[model samples]
Each structure stands twice: as C-alpha cells, then as structure tokens.
Target: MTIDTLDIAASPMPATVPKRSFLQEVIEDTPGSDPRFEMCIQCGTCGGSCPSGPDMEYSPRRIFAMIKADMREEVLKSNTFWYCVSCYYCMARCPQQVHITDLMYTLKRKAVREGYCRKSTASDAPDFSEFFADAVLKYGRSFELGLATRYHLRHHPLGAIKMATGMGLEMMRKGRMDLTPRRIKNVDQLQAILSKAEEIARQEREQGGVA
Candidate 1:
C-alpha cells in the first residue's frame, strides 16, 4: 500500500484544544473592530495589494481564516501582524470593507500587550509606534528627529550615525526637521483631552465595550 504523506490523518493532534472560538472571543473583546470581520469572502484582493504580504508568515486573508480556525497562539505570535506598514492598500482593496489595516494594527497592539511581540525586526513597528506616541503626548506634535534618534540609537547605532550624516543633515539644513520638540501653546488643554479620552477608553474596556 502506498502512503499519502499529505493526508490529514497522518498529522499529530495537539495535546490540548481551546475551549472557545478565537474569532468569536476576539469580536467580543474588541467591539471597535469592523463588523465585517466575519464577512471575508476568501478573496485575494487584500493580500495582492499588500506590499509586505510577500514577506509575511501568513497573508491577510490567511490570517482571517486562521482567526476563524481558533489558531490564537499561532496568529498572535506570527510576524504578519507586525509586518503591516499601514499603507491602507489592504483595507482599500478589501471587497468586504473589512478594515484590514485597522485589524492589523489591533493585532499588533494585542500581540505586544500579550507579550508575544518578537524581539527582532518584527518588533520595530511597535517600538517606533511607542516613540511616536510619546513624542506626540509630550509635544503635541511628532518630532521626527527625536523619534528617529531614539529608534535608531536603540536598535542600530552604527547605521543611525550614517543616516544622521546623510538625510538627517539635509533635513536639518532644509529646516524641515527640528532638533527640539515644540510644544503647542495649548498643550495643557490637549493633555486634558487626552487624559479624558484615556479614561473613557478604560471605562469602555471595563464595561466590555470597544477599547
């Protein structure tokens, strides 16, 4: 008898199985997600438009299916979530209007919160996001020089020096990039609004609403 190595029966089962569906759990946890999460038509449009899809462990469409299949750990740990560049091509091309980019961002945040973010290039996105957010919170505007300096110094010091010598100097000379972050005159009011927004978000999360 000839063996069919590709047969599902030949595969080993996991020791433990999840008690709940991953997709359902996520929907319940994140009410802010597009209501069309379950409406994907398995089309390849989103993946085709994604510039980073070729480098991802799972394409956008495949990740949606994996979510439906309750592959929680695998999906969260995958580099696909972190690889999204927020170019919006996937979301714009999705026939189902699934907000693919938003879902990808949600996944990235969740992965980081759950301690699943990889300590490699896959982590650069979240690290940069943090620096950008901090810069905004502190100065009411993104300080590109500060963000770049912090990111590259922490990640690639040698490459940072080379970049600083090249594009950084050009930007400085053009007066496009500021060495010091400028605070908005009404920054205190902005901070108050931000604090209130955070409070509302916390309340919503506690109430099982969208985060």
Candidate 2:
C-alpha cells in the first residue's frame, strides 16, 4: 500500500551541538551486532509493510541508512524511534532476517541515554515499555487497565485526570477496570527470575564488550 508523505521538510533537525558517539558504545563488531542495519538490502520491504510509517519523520529504510553512516544524533532525535508501534511487520517480512523491532528498541535505549526523550506530560510522554516493566517488576503479571491507569497518572497527569473523569469512570461503571492488582502466587519466585535474567544480560554485555 502506498502511503501519502507527510511534510518532512518542516520536521525539526538535530541540534548543531556536538554529542558523544553512542554508536561505538552500543554496537559490537561481531556479526548480527547490527544485523538489521547491515543486512538491509535497501529493498524498502520494511518500510512498505510498516503500519506506522506514515506517522514517522523518517522511514525505517532512512533510519537504517542514517545509522550505517553513524549519524547518531540525527537518527536519535528523529520521531521515528518514538513512533514505532512494535508491530513486527518489518521483522516478519524481511528476507535478510533483519530484526527491525530490535533495532528500533536499541535506538530508543540510546535516545533515552542521551536524554533526548520527550517529557511525561498530559499529551506526550515516554514509551509505555518502561511503565510495563515497572508493573511487571512490582507484580508478576500485568494488570491491563490498572497498568494503563498507573502509566497515565505517572506520565500524563492531566491526561490521567481527564481519563479518570471521563473514560475511567465509564470503565469502572462497566466493571472493566479492576481496582486491585492480581498478584501471582509465589511472587518472590518471579522476582528472582527477573533479577537473574537482568544479571545474565549485564554479564553478557560485559563479556561481549559491545558498546
């Protein structure tokens, strides 16, 4: 499907100030280190299949090219990183086995590290992944509506108020939003699992020595 182009000319470019090179810090020299980027054949298959492409300041194709050129600041500051819906359409369809979703995630981490993220506000906020992780860290499983409400309140205070005053009340009236979070039995076990996984990841990073 062909998507109409947005006004990319009006989009904000990265600041002229010099910044540290996160590219050298996060990516490794090994194969598949940036597999999605390296393997991309400029097929535009990823961009063609992406549902969120229209809303993005740059397509997945352009973003990968920017990364290949080590244009870290320009790529990170683009709206594409924040707009990815994680639908995995690009990943599922890539003939080169490029993990587009993972690449986007890596970009997001770099953006956050550089403090180039959007602030939590009524309309705009950071990604919901952090909120989801926090909920999972607190409880074993996610409570759908509870998580949503908590995220809204924590990030978008005004949005939360409006949500509560309107949609929240409606949902509560319909018994759709649960007030209490359902705890998984033996929550400590899950906590231990999560902690172990995190430790393993850290060890892998240290050993791999990939930035």
Candidate 3:
C-alpha cells in the first residue's frame, strides 16, 4: 500500500495565457484585408519614401517597432498617422509590401475614436473627417458647404467668416458649390450597406478579430 505521489513542483503547470502585443492587436483589429505588420523587417525604406516624412513624429518602421513593444498609448498619441499623406509611396517602396498606407488609415481612425487625437496639432483633420462622414451618412453624399462650415466655424470662427466670404463665394459663383447636398440614387440602399459595414467594424473592434 506504499503509493508515492509526484511532487507538485515536478508536475506540469496549468497553461498560462499569453498577453498579445499591440502589433498583434492591430493585426487582429484590421478589417477587410489581413494586415502584414508582422512582416516588417526594420528596414528604413518606408521612412525614407514617405513624402511627408519630415512632418511625422515617428517613422512608419519606428512606429511598427513601438507596436511590437506594445506601446499602444505612445503610438496612438503620435502624429505619425495624421501626417501620412496616403500617397502610398512607402508601401510602394517597401520590399515586404506590408500594407503601410492601410495601417496608417486604421491608426487614424483608432486614434480619433480613442480621443488620443485631441492633443495633436492636426486634430482638426479628424473633426473635418467626422463632419464629412456625417454628411455622407445623412445624404448618401458629401455636403462640402455644410462640412466646411461646421469644421471651420468650430476650429476658426474668424477664418470661417473669411473663407465664407472669399473662396466660398467664388466657388458658388463658378457653379462648383451648391446650397444643398445632392442625394445619390438608391440612397437608402447605400445607407443600409454602409450601416452593415459599420456593424461589422464594431464587431471586429470588440472581438479584436480580423474581418
């Protein structure tokens, strides 16, 4: 009846859950196409090829490094994505074809949503983008006048008056500006599609999964 029990220290430990890095989180949260952020090789090509490189707080590769290090707050607070002109030059030049531009766009949306964009000098870009998106959701098309009016008035009241009087009048006179937004045909259908897309995005964000 001599039964010896195995030592607890020698026994297998329970499986420990591994924490995900910011890079993995970004890849998971990226919708539509798979993000190749993990493919980044620390090359300086992306940084050198950016047209607005000088304006950014961090180069794309450096940002990728930060993401790898799980520096979510630092990455989101950076003006790097805002300065990305979306010219695609960096993506074009990268030997890895790492979806640089798309990643930048994703970061932009994430930063704005998380309220990290307010401390940025380029924060107005997010506000204007929101106004433009609201107009599209409302009319199934952009209302340039309304968008500009709302954005400028909120950011620069004096400049808004000047812009309304100056270039705004000229554009209206030239028939390039309209008093109202023209609704696209089958606008309800468009809205439904857009709403569905939004629903998918929300689900992806919440689940931290890719589309």
Candidate 4:
C-alpha cells in the first residue's frame, strides 16, 4: 500500500482534462461533501467499524486502497459501496475523519451513472432504492406490499407469485401489509419541500458544486 512501491496502472475510466487520478476524481465527484479519501491511512478502522463489511466484495479499507490505485472498474463494480447501510459508524470512528458514508454515496452514484451497478453482484440495491423512493414520493409513506410485489416481480417473478399466495396473504390477513398506500396529511407541503430541494440541487449542479 506504500505509494512508492505500488505499481500504477491505467484506469478503466476515461481520462480527462490534464488527466485526473482516480483519487482526485473521487474527491471531485463528491463535491460539497468533502470526502477526504486521500487521508486514508489503511488503518482498517473503517472496515472494522462497518457492520456490512463482511458481506462486501471488498472492505471499505480495501476499496480506499483500490481507489488510490486507480482501479476504477474494480472499485465501481464492487459490492462494498452498495452494501453500505449508511450507519456512519465507519465515518465516526475514522481517525482521519474520512466521510466513509458520504463517500459510499458518491461511489454509488458513480457506479449507477457509469453502468457498473448493473454489472455488480449487489445490483439489486439500486432497484430497491428506486422502488422505495417512488413509494415515498407517491404516497408519502412506504407501501411494503407494493414494494415487495414490485421488487419480487421484477427480480423473481416466481417468488412474487409465491409470496402473494403465501406470506403476502398472511401479512394482509394480519394487517401487516395493506393492499393500498396511505397519503400523508399534507402531501402538497411535502411535494413543495421536495421540489425546493430538487431545485437547489439543480442549481448546485449548474455551478459544478454537485456531481
């Protein structure tokens, strides 16, 4: 992991401008969040603090090392960032105060935009997130039955049918899974808030303050 001894290789991602290193690209990609990826010391602290580290294709610490190595293909296609639960334990415990959680978000965006998420083992993460977000925006509350039905149908049609006939029916019988979604009391207010946030984000992107 020593910079002097490490062998540098061409990144799978396209080079740009004066040619930015993968590390610099990551830092730039997460603008405003200020992910201090360069400050990583290979202490293994982030990996140790991560609850999902064991399930990741690469641990957080290793992902950092790979990032510095300019292993764009490997890093972006990894399950490390996708499996992150955003619990913030890793970020809080890092001596360098690397924004581990925020960095994961940055990486997730890169993975999705670059089409790497589709090639990843944790590819379902994005689909699940999209379903959840859609539910929230439409109903102002999570519709578990709809979420499960849609997710299962898209990923596992057979499982979806089985669930609808079996576990799903039981959940509905017990009132755990409602057949319909419920709107919040003030849906317009929520929409206004979300719209304002999106507007600010759009402005930030125009200013190169967000990527």
Strongest candidate by lDDT: 4
- Candidate 3 structure lDDT: 0.86
RMSD of 2: 11.8
Q: Find the 10 residues in a row with the least total lDDT in model 2.
A: 118-127
Instruction: List where candidate 3 sits over 4 angstroms from the true fold.
Output: 1-16, 207-211
**When superposed on Cα atoms, how far off is each prediction in RMSD?**
7.3, 11.8, 5.0, 6.6
Residue-level lDDT tens digits of model 2 in 106-163:
7777676566665312124454767777777888777777767778877778998898
User: What is the model-wide C-alpha lDDT for candidate 1?
Assistant: 0.82
lDDT of each residue in 16-111, candidate 3, tens digit only: 666666687678666567668889999989999988988889999899999888888889988899888889898888898899888988788778
lDDT of 4 by residue, 1-211 (tens): 6787754565565565567687887788785656778899999999998898899989999999999989999999988898999999998899999988888988998898789999999988888888988899887999898899889899989989998999988988898878889999998899889889989977976875544
Error of 3 at 80 (Å): 1.0
lDDT per prediction? 0.82, 0.73, 0.86, 0.87
Q: Single out the weakest 10-residue window by summed lDDT for candidate 1.
A: 26-35
- The C-alpha stretches of model 4 lying farther than 4 A from their native spots are 1-21, 28-34
Q: Please give the range of 10 consecutive residues that has the lowest summed lDDT in model 4.
A: 7-16
Clashes of 4: 0
Residue by residue across 1-211, what tens digits does model 1's lDDT show? Answer: 4565566665676556544476765665554645578989999898899898899989999999999988878888888978888899887778888867777877776787777776434766678888999999988999999999999999899999999999999999998898898889999999999999999988986775546
